[model samples]
Target: MSWTKKVLRINLTAGTCSPEPLNMEWVEQFLGQRGLATKYLTEEVPPTTDALSPENTMYMITGPLTGTMASTAGRYSVVTKSPLTGAVACSNSGGFFGNEMKCAGWDMVILEGKSPSPVYISINDDKAEILPADEIWGKSVWEADEWLHTKHQDPQLRVAAIGVSGEKGVLYSAIMNDLHRAAGRSGVGTVMGSKNVKAVVIRGSKGVDVQDPKAFFDATNAGKKILAENPVTGEGLPALGTQVLMNVINEMGAMPTNNWKDSVFEGASKISGEAMLEPRDSDGKANLTRNGACFACTIACQRVSTIDPEHFSVQNRDDLHPSYHANSGGLEYEAAWALGSDTGVDDIDALTYAQFVCNEQGLDPISLGSTIAAAMEMYEEGFITKEDTDGIELNFGNAEAMIKCTELVALGEGFGAELGQGSSRFCAKHGHPELSMTVRGQEFPAYDPRGIQGMGLGFATSNRGACHLRGYTVASEVLGIPIKTDPLETEGKAGLQIAFQNATAAFDSAGICIFTSFAWSLEDVAPQLNAACEGEWTPERLGEIGERIWNLERLYNDAAGQGASADKLPPRLTEEAVKTGPAAGKVNGLATMLPEYYAERGWSPEGDVTADTKARLGL
Candidate 1:
């Protein structure tokens, strides 16, 4: 069967691990991964419950296709209430871990209640245990991972672990797996830390089987062929990875620079994908070692890169980890924009070092770097002094200052403790809330909404704060994946955003990479699922499931006080205009779009799901 048909429930308070039957009914409705996990969360955890309390429940779930022969089927999601945003948090990650979980005969691992002391979960097929983590309790993710492998004497053990920043309660801490891949948003790791979970180590030998082996083989082969022929998936992504977006986004005037004070960065080309390929002066080698891939991923878009040894950031730093000396997960577009352009730093090596620190210490670089940008703005505006930043001059373009901030925040020490609260709270505390550049207390991503209008609407209503991954209208507006649309126009974008959002939800639920959508639509995805699982999965059915999942998450956030009133952007985006580039003299017209979006979603004017709509979805 495609379904493992088993759920592992780990109660830390009782120090017990029990197997529960998979709810087939919920699986049919929600599909898997994000949707199914959220359903379990809604049933077990209350939205009003304190996110850091023992009451909160965390679910690590995989999709039906995970660990199978399907391409890019290695995705997993961590679902829980976010301590950072006070809303639903579902951070997706890709690595060997999801495949391991599925192979270990589990579809989901649900953690309930808090442990009295630091502990790690060790899973070996059907056997599971919670063991003391006193030795690795205060270690970084990399350090803990090393310790686990050494102690277990199993180099293949897949580990998802938090770092010292997480243990210290950094609001944007992430869970790093396979050394570099991360569930890197909405403070999922902070919640893990609060529950005293230091790490999850798993190894599996039982392989996944689909409903029909011959049909599954045909379906997967066809899917992989589509990826191979598509330019975005086959050539562009594999050649330069997500770093390809740095220059393209900057050229489009959608790159948010200096905390959204401007929409263009002069250093865009200097820190772009092309730059990563240029030979370094010291060793005559490029930063990128090669392209890598997740389990069964044919695209091979994951970047493996290293910092230049002679670069100022790491040249004399004995504090740097040995892995930094070698190759690791490199700067993607989001990390580059946040740490490089948004903060006014052009040094690629410095950005690389900062990204390494993020993976090493389990911090969300997007939130961390964006928070630093806000601090830089506040420092320049005389809102904060050097004394406030522990005597570090935090002016924009100060690479040393940015690196210092990264190191401090990695440990959650000194002034880093304040920065760990995230940009929205940090800016508000410094008497400059308007400069935060956020929606729902989460920092905005690479694309500036002023240039790409639909993103503003997507960011405003995202269930998990100001995240771009939730809807990603950029495919249509900027890349024109399926069809070309005017980036500046507000007309018809309401329907466009809804289409992308619902479709994305389906892709995320199906245990696949959303990047596949660059070429494949739901029409392409339906056949794969239908062949693998025992179901009649059509594009229309998947679309309905996606809509239902969106409404369900919306209801949860509504009850958590992040209701329709919270669906909005910072005044800077709505009130101030873009100062330069193609979108100069323009501000985001979110007000003109939200009403239309609500109507398209069959929701009330206030953005609440109507009773009739709920009944239609059978919610």
Candidate 2:
């Protein structure tokens, strides 16, 4: 079977490491990864428990397909209640960490109770221990990672560590693994920091054994063939590395610019994927050095990039890490948009520098940039001033200012301390709650939902707040991945959003990249899962599991006091229309779509999962 069928329970309060059998019944009901971990969260931690307190448990878990030959099987999730949203937080990351965890003879690592002092977890094979992290606690992710590798004397050790931002309790901080891959969003790292954890370093030599290796190989190989043949997964993503969408979304008039006051960005082309390939450095190298991939990924959409040393963000900045000058992970499309067009800054080098800081410091670039953008809008409106920003020019398109804010947030110092609270709290504290472009206290990503109608519903109703990954309707509404749908029309969007959300939940639970959905569906995913695990998997069954997962998370939110009422867009999105391009004069019709969405989901008119629906899904 794909599952290791064992879990490592670490009670930091007791400094004890124990192993327990996994709940096979729950695994069958929830599948794995996001779904399974969420099951643990809902059962162990109270919905109203303070997200940063010892009562809130953390699940660093892997799915069934993890550590196997399945495409994108390296996926892992950090599941806990979010300090940012006071709701469920499940942030996924792609790296070698998930595989290592599974190979270490554990399907999940349950971290509960707060440690008395700063510490880190080190696991090798079946042995695990908690050790003092005094030397690495306050360091950046890169510094801590280097120290861990050197001390352990294992260059191949997979380390997931939070940077200074996380250690100091930046609300939107992330856990960075394999240097740049992050379990990003919804303040999971803040939870880890609150628990007094600094890092998790693992080295595993055991291997996974599938139920039917031949069947698994065939199914996985066929899946990889689909990815390699698809245009979005094979050609566009590999060539442009998700930064492909900067120009495409901008051209479609869906790119959020200037904190989403504008749907079109004039500087979009200047900082696009094509521009990333253009040589602008004194060394005559493009900002993008090459494409990289997560463990077992065939598409290889990750960007390995370098910043120009002459750029003002890095020039004479000895305080900056050396990673700023060399090749490292670069900005993807979302980071580019949030740090670039959303803030009105088109300087690629500046964006690259800020992106490096985000990776090095383990910050969620989406919330970090969106927070600064909100602050910029407030400053320009005279709602806030130089006094609020500590005399810094919080203006749109000010690359230096943007970089400064990013660095501050990374280190949790100066004005950065205020910005690190995330856009929702930052704006509300400044007395302009309407300026925050967030839902459920989490910032929206690059898309301007005003242009894409389905995404509005998706964002408003997202279980983990305003995240595109919860239901990336952009794939269907804009790219026509499965079928073409009108991006402007609200009609039929409800069912579409439901379908995508259900399918996405399944993908997340299956231990594969959601990017695989650009080419694969539950129909394609079922075979691989069936071949790997001891189950008779089918698309319809997987879909039911997905729906169960979604409704379960919804039920958790309802108890957490963030359900239904939190499913709303900002005044700017529902009231203000786009100002230019094809979406000019258009606003999101969330009101029209939300009710239909609820009805399709078999929820009440108020958006509560009905008794019949819960019974049908066995929730």
Candidate 3:
């Protein structure tokens, strides 16, 4: 009964939007959101298909718990082939959009073929239309969002849109929703732009219903209690947001400073969560104004922040968006690390300004900042000249240079186009492939593989490229959610990584935030699903489903030729030793862990899903 059993198929080339029945059989096997959408992608698009081509299909999907009272249930995923990695991409986001989509009675929206001109999909309950978007096509996400709302005069409308970065073919463009929240990794927005789809606006009046109302209430309320009691999900996240990790990771010697040449940053504390709360000298205001929540989210980890108006980045800037002048989406840990630490900038206001620009213009800050870091390395090495950077001095620790690169990339102009292709391509072009700290063409987040041993293996074997969300060993290795593990020791990390990977797949598929995993396990999740969904949902069954999903994504990547060979860390991580603190003189033990990981998963030594494993999962 939780299943809407509806699909919206939009063919941009033919200018057709048709309704189709959801495959009930697939739904039973794969569940919903990431898992269900992947099943559609595998059937429709071939492994060899060009990610930016019309042949590569895109799925905008909601899970079974979506539009429900489940905590963090507003999450949705943009599933497609990534233009940056040429691998399957599923980028999740939270805001009001997913709930609206489900309320409109659609479980998924599939896009195929390219439009002759720029267009947007607007849905109001059963009514849906494709409208010309010429006026807003090249605008920033903020500009486009405002234009759409004013044009339609629907104050309640929820919009997910791209910006000039997406429209201009920036490979790492994001799909921004709620003006700030994003499906922010792996270039999902690039694929959207390739199809000439600029935005999707939705408004739904039909409310969501579950199978067992009384049991659903009991299950959900119990889950909320667990979150409230847990320290990480309750106090830590709510008080500091994700920026809390800035000082913690730095102290651990895993901060990945100056493009990962060092393990620690000298200026970590100045850009930390605690610092965000400290009153600034100018107007005595803190960078963080307040905490916020997505639909039904009680944790309220979302940060609302204002840049120091007197800071050089924003001072006297006449072209700044109104959001920059006031509180907006603040810097998360990854964005702060990439823009500040990795580039050696360390100016808090500059990082905040860059983050706002990223949201406004639909760019992935991880890729954007990491790419510029690589460019800075090249400039310092004299591999490239100031002429190549369009007269801007591309130097590490120069906040002005960092800000300039950000603005240029948002517009996809001049030197920005080169940087927009991501660090892998940029480094390769400059004959320094070793300089790009990436796995499968996607930039790694803040954690250094050398310090956090399991994370290295996690990044290497991650199906979606160097992503923490896919499987966060950090919970155990660092925060010790379920149990504490040695962050330096590689003894049991293979098993640790596998467990996290499988469990995370379940969490992601169930339409809940992985942050909830800090307190709630699948055992906690099973009661809610068993009541809300039609079938029996034991922890055992959910575990198997998570494992099945992991294998499915792995098999798809293998078929796409990003096989076992692509499962590797960069040379700099494997060859060079970290220079400071607890992890001094250490390198990642991925080689020692890879074989054990393969054996635990019951895959072949070559890292392909075995016939026996496939039969066991009934794949």
The residue-level lDDT of candidate 2 at 585 comes to: 88
lDDT by residue for model 1 over 257-276, one digit each (tens)? 88889899999999999999
- The Cα error of candidate 1 at residue 546, in Å, is 0.5
lDDT for predicted candidate 2 compared with the true structure: 0.93
**Models ranked on lDDT:** 2, 1, 3
List of clashing residue pairs for candidate 2: none
Model 2, 66-139: lDDT tens digits are 99999899999999999999989999999899999998888999999999999999999899999999998889
TM-score of 3: 0.99
Write down the TM-score of every candidate.
Answer: 0.99, 0.99, 0.99
Summing lDDT over every window of 10 consecutive residues in candidate 1, give the lowest-scoring window. Answer: 312-321
lDDT of 3: 0.92
Residue 108: error of model 2 in Å?
0.3
lDDT of candidate 3 over 1-619, digit per residue (tens): 6668899999999999999999978877778888888888888999889999999999999888988998888888899989999888999999989988999988888889999999999998888899999999989999999999999999999999999999999999999999999999999999999999999999988888899999999999999999999898889999999999999899999999888999999999999999999999999999999999998898999999999989998889888888898999998999999999999998999999999999999999999999999899999999899999999898889999999999999999999998999999999998999899899999999999899999999999998899898889988888876899999999999999999999888888887787889899999999988877788778888888889888888888888887698989998888899989999999999999999999999999988899999999977
